[model samples]
Target: MTEDLMLLQEKVTLLRSEGKYKETIEACQHLLEWGMAANDHKSVLVAHLHKIASYYCIGDIEEAFNNIGTYIELCSIYGDELDKLNLNNILFLLYEFNKDFNKAKATLEVSIALGKKLNKYIIISNGYSNYSHIYCAEENYEDALKMAKEGLDTAKLLEPASPILELRVKLNMAKAYIGLENFEASKSLIDEMINDPILDSFIREKSNCYDLQGNWYSKQTLYREAFESYTVAKNLVESYNDVYLLKAIQAERCKLCDLMNDVQLGYLVQKEYIAILNQISNRELELVALRLNIKHSITDIEKKANTDYLTGLFNRKYIEYTANQWLEQASITNDNIVCIAFDIDNFKSINDTYGHLFGDEVIQHVSKSFSKKFGEHDLVGRYGGDEFIIILKNISLSDGKIKAEQIEESFKSIEMMKNGLSISITASIGVSDNSGGSVVTFTDLFQKADVELYKAKLLGKNQISCGS
Candidate 1:
């Protein structure tokens, strides 16, 4: 059974290496079931840990947390001090990911205490390293520097010093110094790591060094030097096809562009950032669905998160968030902003005449049509049971009214079939614009459009009304 488990573990590794994250998780699940049935506590723990890694690789934070919960439970029941220490470290990372800084700090303290009690230098060093990173993230450069130095000192006292561990501490120290505006010290540390022959084999570390150098240069207003360093880091990560590193580099580049006041370049970089984020999000959703044995795909989860489940259009929460952001931007740029609110002409009657499911089909069809009619930058969301909202940027009132008319026409042309009967769909739309306003809020715009929509309904449905 142990040999079988080892073989299964190998298969999981191979699948993960091949980017088959779903298959890797499925194999881990099978191994876990076998371990439980065979009463193989060690194998069960290992399987759970493996599943956690696979879930993290696929960026499924929630699923990773679930597996970590099980792993921690098993560790308490059947693990050694070392296992407990490692589990605490994992818990620290999970809490950190959720931005629960207090919990992460507590977990790190537990790891440090256990490592000291067990006389484990590696664990002690790693705990300090992680603690330093947390401080750096929170902008506590002095504390970060102290923790990093402590970690390095502890690492140096190991019977056989670990160069990789030492290098990691050095990197943390460099970052802390960078945060402190001590460019010379930061440069010295980064240069030391780059000059070390032992570190040459670690491409990711090399890339990180360049990225830090880029950050330091950017902070000093050396835009050209920063760009060069960022390019080097990007090229190194690109050679390894490290998507996460690539994403980080792109984000840095975006910030640099913004700092340089290159709005066009910043916009391009922002688009790339969104694209990468979406990819990561989709991959995470896929791993989560697989772990839960759900039949839906990543796209399905994404759709359900941001869109109305029944109509397959953006949900109210998403639209509100995005629309607020656009409104803020419009205020800064003096851009025209328009809001449209619309609902089915006789939605309640349709639901009463046909079944609710048939009514749902009508909503779905109309939502799809609205999605097709809008620009990529436009925002459309299901505001309520039978109502939808759209926010258009940099469009005039006349153009918005034209769009509203087009929407009404397109939706009215749709045919809904139920019980061998055909029904024509029509909608009433209310449009509002913030073209000449000093300041406009989402609530104000929504209310204005909604009032106009009421007027349209009162004047007879399947018509458009405009408001200033």
Candidate 2:
């Protein structure tokens, strides 16, 4: 029975590798039944876990949970701390996707405790690393940093020469330092890692390290270097269809485009973006898998022509193009149009004090907050670093200010960076409505809003000063 189960497991693994989730799940079920009949708990548990993993792979949270619940029950029955760690980690992932930070934290704690009890150093280190990730999600950089270091130290003790461990620890630490505004330190660590001969031979580590390095450069406003790093990371990730790294690298590329002030070019890069997004999305179909790894070879030449990379917001060039078209229609219909300009207060200080990593978190948080606060018809874009512009269709100046205020308040609720340290953000806003006159050009409106934004900044950094 064990041998049969092993053979079944191998075949299922091949199917899954080929992206045949449906067939793999069916095979897994058969193996599971056989293992259960033979009272082979280990094989049974493995089958259950693999199926759960597959469910998660396709973004099926509910089904993933169903399988996980059974896996946990079986693990408890057999007293397998290792399996418990795996289950806990999966739960953490689910909670993370659900945005249930508190639950994720609890799950990670349980996983770590189990690891310690079982004397599994690797699991314990991994648990700590996972725990730190939760803090990262909440923008708690201080605690995240401490935990990352602790995990690295533990991992070091277990596998001193392990490039994988070294790179991961350094990467997380670099992120923490970035949030803390220690750019030099962050750069130094990244340089050392990249220069190391060991990283060259290890694909995953080399790829991830370069990604981190690219992010750091982007935060420092080093556009060309940032682009290079992102390019390298993307190349490495695409070679293996590594979904996690694929998204991460794509994000870095987005940031690079923002720093370069080249939104059109960035969009071109995003055309490949849609392709990759579709590939990951299709993981649900359970169709033939053609190696679902990220296409690392996607070059800047293949992205969309209308999207920005940083903050995942549309770029100014795209916004201008869109706004102009809308303006033409509104003028013909005698409809109202409004434009808003906003800036993060002391953005440079945020970068200087907390580091660019934290600075990035602030930008992303603000961008997402704005999206949630505004109407669907409203157009928003990252005008540049520390700046954003919005276009409102058929909205009043008062309403625009209200919307701006709501977005600013939402930003206040988010920590600028997640790890351990806590940081807050503030912005100044300027709004203009088309009600002022129908003869005004889009550029005129932009200038007026820019003036208002500057006045808001002059009044004081944290307050939103709005005007016509």
Candidate 3:
């Protein structure tokens, strides 16, 4: 079995080295399955790390997080410096791709410290390059330029004429110069990189530099030169389909065409702008109407989709969706996630005691109190009739229970109305924690909260019960 595993690893390495990423990933998965079955922790760790690299190569940031997290944990536990460094690199890329600049900078700091301590010049150079990118994203152009220059200097000291590192640093410096309105400096940097005889293989980097150059040209009202730069940028951006660069280049092209009195081209640009505008409008409509209804907000369409017409809280579906999102974010961030399920005690009896119209007023009053006490972050949805669900974030178990009690107390203070009548109400509450790895799915959290809610009902109404 050991010999067979070794052979499999070798083949996997060969495939990966040959750039057969798909086949390499397949073999890695098979290895992972076998490792899990055998309960071999080392193999499991290696398989996970390799999978993270494959995922990074393919630009799947979210999927990489879970595996990368596991790998980071295992490497820290086992004191593997090399694994730690590799995970840091993958994490840097993942966070950058996800637009989490703060986390990316934090990860790069740790990676750079380790690389410097270990005298890993290549890793150190990569760390500087990535850190410069974070500074660039944060719009700290001075810091970005300094870091990029440091990276280039380090790479040059470690190895002579490193073309890739030089290209990256030059492009970064161009971006910094552009941000500083040092257009001449920016153009100089771009021209040097473009004239570099060895940059032939860095097509993407060169294209991006051209896009930045075009942006500077457009800003300076150099239309013909800007047109050439934007044309190349448009071609490159189209090939990549990068939304950020595409939008920027298209906007520049539109302005230049307008400036040049190209009416036909301007109309074409206007058509494309209209298309993008319509796309955004539809997306906003979907988000505001459907998603808000399914989540927490009141919209015209969702008002129809998720309201009882008589009561203004929520329909049944909204409660389930909001509860699930709360649970998921809590699980990922390791923060306290809690849910409160409650109902107006003796609601049917209240209708019987007074009238159905009075009962409707009691429901509305309770929901209004719920919305008032809970912040926008908390989810409050009516779960049919007198029942309601509230999902809270970033609160501890004790704090969550306190919140439930407060909601109950606040409800008692509200004066409900029928037509010209006043009435009072009481509610039974349940609370549950969604805070640990042992919790399998979001449903478990909901079920646990529901169980406590049942306990509250059983123990007698107008009280609260908490899940253990």
lDDT (0-100) at residue 198 of candidate 1? 79
lDDT (C-alpha) at residue 400 in model 2:
79
Local distance difference test scores for all models:
0.83, 0.75, 0.74
- Against the true structure, candidate 1 has what lDDT? 0.83
Q: Is candidate 1 or candidate 2 better by lDDT?
A: 1
Model 1 alpha-carbon drift over 4 Å, by segment = 2-20, 255-468
Return model 1's CA RMSD, one decimal.
Answer: 17.9
Best by lDDT: 1
2 or 3, which is superior by lDDT?
Answer: 2
Model 3, span 372-441: residue lDDT tens: 8887666677777788887777787789899998898797679866557676688888899875635535
Give the least accurate 10-residue stretch of model 3, judged by summed lDDT: 290-299
lDDT of 2: 0.75
lDDT of 1 by residue, 1-468 (tens): 878977887887788789787777667767775776678887777777766767766667777887787788789899888677767866786788888877998988898889889888888898899899999989999999999999999999898778988998999999999999898999899888878887578888888889888988888899868878997898888777676778888888887887788898788878977887887777667656665652244345445557777876788877876787777888888888899999988889999998788888888889888778887778888998889999998889889999998897787568778879888888899999875654467887788899999999999878899986
lDDT of 2 by residue, 137-180 (tens): 67788888888888887788774456576567777777777777
The weakest ten consecutive residues by lDDT in model 2 span 293-302
- Clash totals for all models, in order? 0, 39, 0
Best first by lDDT, ranked = 1, 2, 3
Determine the backbone clash count of candidate 1: 0
